[model samples]
Structures are given as C-alpha cells and as structure tokens.
Target: MSRIPVLTPETATPAQAEIFAKTVAKFGKNPLLMSTMTNSPAMMNSYLTLFQNLTDGRFDKKLARKIGLAIGEENGCEYCISLLAAIAKLQKLTDEDIELARHGKSTDAKEEALLTFVLLLVRHKGDLTNAEVQAVKDAGWSDEDVSEVFGHLILNFLTNYFWKVARTDIDFPVLRLYDQSKIARGNH
Candidate 1:
C-alpha cells in the first residue's frame, strides 16, 4: 500500500481528472507516479506540465530516460527506477543497457561519462568541483549540453524524491521483474 492515499480519477478534480485522462490516453494507463502526484492536484498539474513541456520534443528521450534511471538508482528509488525503465524500454533501450545503467555501468563511452557525472552530482548533492565539470566538458559535451544535463538532474531529483516520500507501488511490468537482490543491495 502507498504511504499516502492516491487520488483516483473518480475523486480527482476536473483538472486532475483531465491530467489522468491525458496520461491514460498518451501512455495507455495512468502511471503510478501520476497517482502519487495526485496528493496535491496543483502541484501534480505543475509537475505534469513541466514534464510534458521540458521533455516534449527537446531532448533524446532514450538518453533522458537513461539519465533518469541512473539518478533513480543512485537515490535508491525503486519506484522511479521502474518508471524510467519502462520509458527506456519504450525508447528501445535494451534490457541489458537498462540493467547496466541502473547498476552504474554503461558500455557506451558517452553514457558512461554521463552516468559518472550524474552519480557524482547525486553523491555530492550538486556540489560539483571544477575538475568534475571540466571532465564532462572534455568528454565532448558543450556548455549548453552541460546546462541541459543539470536540468535533467533537477527533473529526476524531483520525481525520485517524490517516489521516496510517496512510497508509490510498482505497477509497471518491467519494474515488477526487478531483481530483489539488486534492489536490496542498492546495486541497481
């Protein structure tokens, strides 16, 4: 059970109801994360809007999902991990790559560098050293890309923190198949 009650589509306000409807329409089901967000309809709406606007057609959804999964793993947020894993799969990321990113390993150099930077940011709570920033830049990311990375980190942090606080249930199939040992060990 969730620590807080999830506001269902029936009980939600018109705005919340519409959001839920839109979610179901776009994704085929209202994600558990959306249910968690219903704790405060206004907040949920704002968050949903931000999620839709920021990620609409801007960045590579696959890369963004991988980044989110990395942050979720570092935070030990199983709910967020599962949620992003589903999104990653929709973006065509292989199961192996998803597992690897969750475990803080990526075969691709760019992915490896991105995950390393994100993990370090999470470890230090965004207090990155100049050298760390330089390393990311040296890895061929432009200053604009670096800024966008921070944006992704901030977005992931919000959702991950919500997952921790809400203790949302894992409703997605891929997330349901997560290895218990890996989760218990905080390894992924």
Candidate 2:
C-alpha cells in the first residue's frame, strides 16, 4: 500500500483530470508516480512540464535513463530505480549496462565522466569544487551539458525524495539497490 493515494481519472479534480489527459496523450497512460502526485496539481504540473522539457534537453533518452539510474541508486529509491530500469530495458540497455549505470559507471569515457560527476553532485549535495567541474569539461562535456546534468539531478532529486515520502508502490518491475549476484552469494 502507498502512503499516498494514487488518483485515477474518475477520482481526480478538474485540474488533475486535465493533467491526466495530457499524461495519457504523452505516455498512453498515467503512471503510478504521476497519479500519486495528483495530490498537488501545481506540483504535478510542474513535474510534467519539467519532464517534457528534459526529454527535449541535451541528453538523449538513453543517457538520461543512465543518469536517473545513478541518482536513483545513490538515493536508494527503489521506485525510481525500478522505473528507470524498465525504461532502460526498453531502450535496449543490457543487464550489465544497467548494473554499471546504477554504479555511476559507463563504458564510454565521456559518459563515465558525466556519471561520476553526477554521483559527486549527489554525494556532495551539489557543492562540487572547481576542479571537479573542470574534470568533466576536460572529458569533452561542454558547459551546457554540465548545466543540463544539474537539471537532471534536480528532476531526479524531486522524484527520489517524493518516493521516499510517498512510499509509492513500485508499478514497474522491482529493481533492488544491491547487486543480485552479491545477494545470491550472501554478500549483500
């Protein structure tokens, strides 16, 4: 059970219903996270608007999903991790790729730099040193790319914190925090 009630179209207010329509148009269905967010129409609208904008932002969907995986795992938000993993699988990321992303790693050097920076941002609460920022730039990311990653961080932070508070039921396949291999070996 969720700490927050997941609103349906039938139970939504006029504004929430309108938002649900937009969600349906964009995603074919309103996801459980968005449904639970209907408690505050303004916040939900802001989330949707930010989500729309980020989808058109500098990072491609695959990169964005990787960034989300890193952040979700760092925050230990199973809901966000599960959602990102489902999307990552749809984008054809191998299971190995998904696990690496959750660890803030990538086979691509530039992507690895970005994921490392993202984890730093999360761990330091966005108080990165100048050299830290320059390291990512040196790895071939432009200033604009760095800024966009911050946007991704903010977006993920919102959902992560929300999931922590809402205790929203995982609507996607469950993606636990630790490595399953480790768990099987009694290491986790």
Candidate 3:
C-alpha cells in the first residue's frame, strides 16, 4: 500500500487530472509512480518537466534508461529498480545490459565511464571533487554530458526517495534484486 493515495483520472482534482493527462500523453499511461506523485501536483509537474527535458537531451534513450537503473540500484529503491528495468526492456536493453547497468557498469568503455561517474555522484551525495569531474571528461564525456548526468541524478533521486517514503505497490513485473524487507529497512 502507498503511504500516499494514488490518484486516478476520475478521482483526481482538475490540477491533478491535467497532470495525468500530460503524463498519459508522454508515457501512454499514468504509472503508479506518477499517480502517487499527484499527491502533490507541484511534485508531479516538476518530475514530468525534468523527465521530458532529459529525454530530449543529448544522451540516447538506452543510456538514459541505464542511468535510471544505476541510480535506482544505488538508492536501493525496489519500486524504482523494477520500474526502470521495465523501461529498460522497452528500450531493448538485454538482460546482461540491464544487470550491468544495475551495478553501474557497461560493456562499452565510454558508457561504463559515464555509469561510474553517475554512481560516484550518488555515493558521494553529489560532493564530487574537481578531479572527479575531469576524470569523466578524460573518459570522453563533454561538459554537456556531465550536466545531463546531474539532471538525471536529480530526477532519479527524487523518484527513488519518493518510493522509499511512499512504499507504493509494485505495479510492474517485480525485479527483486535483494530482500524487500531489507531494502525497506535501509539495509541495502
């Protein structure tokens, strides 16, 4: 059960209904995460805006989805991990690819570097050093890519923390990486 009530098209207020409509337009359906986010219209709107913008940014869809998985795993948010895995499948990522991404790795060296950088951001709670920023650049990432990674970090962290707080029901095909009780208890 969700700590926050999941809003539906019929049950939502006009503001929330409009947000749902936008969500459906963008994602083809209102996901449970999006529905739960409607407890605060501002939060839903912020999430949607960043999500839309990031999808349109330089990183390809596959890499973007991989970034989601890496962040979800690092945060130990089962809901987010499952959600991102479903989306990763939709993006045609192989099981190997998905698994590697969950561990913040990639077969491709460039991608692995970026994934490593992303985890560094998560582990350090964004307290990265100047050398850390330059290291990813040395791995062939540009300033724009770094900026987009930060954008994704913020977007993913918001969703991860929300799931941690909400304990929302898993609506996707559950992708359990560890004991759910442990994750919920912050043992990850």
Candidate 4:
C-alpha cells in the first residue's frame, strides 16, 4: 500500500494539477509516481523540470531508457522497472533490448558503455576511482555523457528512494528482473 493517497490532477492543488497535466503530456498518463508526487507541487515541478532537461537535451533515448532500466534493476525497485520498461516499449525498444538493458549489457557499443558506467554506481555504491572514470571515456563517451549519467542517476534515485520509503502499490504491471533481488531506483 502507498503511504500516501495518489491524487489525480482534478483533485490536486492548482500547481500540482498543472504539473499532472505536464506529466500526462510527457508520459501519456499520469503514472502512480506522478499521482503520488501531487502531494507536493514543488516536487512535481522539480521532477518535471529535471525530466525535461534530461530528455530535451542530446540524450539518446535508447541509452536513456537502458540507463533507467539498469538503475531500477540494480537498485531493486519493481515499480521503476515496470514503468521504465513500459516507457521503453513506447519508444520502440524490443523485448530483447529491454532484457539486455536490465543487466546493463547491450549489443550497441555506446549503450553498453553508458550502462556500464551507470551500473558501476549501483554495484559499488557510488564509489568511483579515477581509473574507472577514464575507462568510460576510453569507451568513447564524452565528459558531457558522464555528466548526464549523473543527472539520470539522480532522477533514478528519487524514485528508488520513494519506493523504499513508501512501499507504494505496484501500478504498472510489474517488470520483475529474473532475480528477486528487487528493483527501483525510484517508484517510477
């Protein structure tokens, strides 16, 4: 059960309602995470801003989705895995691709490098040696790519922590990684 009630835009405060509309426009639906976030307008807006900044920039959608999946899976948040998987499907990611991304492996070399970089954070709990950073660069990702990885991970962490703290109900069908080790870098 969610620790808080999930509110639809119609029932939300004005600012939250506007953000809910933005969420719907962005994702086609106001997900449970969005509804849950309606509790705080500032939070909703902050989330919306970060999402837009990351997506509107030069992010490769495929890589971004894969990064999201890796973060969700490694952190063990079911809600996030399900939500991200569904979104990835909407972006035309094949089931094969989604599966590969769950473990941070990809047939695409660039995606593989990015996923590896993001996964290192989860696996090592954010401890990175300089050599580790250089390896991602050696794989051909630029410093800009690394900076965006931080943005994506920060986004992932928000929902991961939300799931951990709320134990929110699974609104998405639930994308369970092969291992029950759990999922969610955030609720979404």
Per-residue error for 123 in candidate 3, Å, reads 0.4
> On residues 99-186, what C-alpha lDDT tens digit does candidate 1 reach at each position?
8888666888876777788888888988999999888888877777777777787678888777767766788764632445434543
The candidates, ranked best first by lDDT, are 3, 2, 4, 1
Ranking by TM-score: 3, 2, 4, 1
Clash pairs (backbone) in predicted model 2: none
lDDT of 2 by residue, 1-188 (tens): 77789998889999989989888888777888879887898998888889889999999999999999999888878889899899899999989889999999999999999999999999998898999999999999998999899889889989988877777778899988774442232222
- CA deviation > 4 Å runs, candidate 4: 183-188
User: Candidate 1: misplaced stretches above 4 Å?
Assistant: 56-58, 174-188
Q: For every candidate structure, what is the RMSD over all alpha carbons to the true structure, in angstroms? A: 3.6, 4.2, 2.0, 3.0
**Best-matching candidate per TM-score:** 3
Of candidates 3 and 2, the better by TM-score: 3
Provide the lDDT at 22 for model 4.
86
Best by lDDT: 3
| Candidate 3 structure quality by residue, lDDT tens digits, 26-103 | 988988988999889998899999998998999999999899999988888888888888888898999999999999
Q: What lDDT score is found at residue 188 in candidate 3?
A: 37
* Backbone clashes in model 4: 10
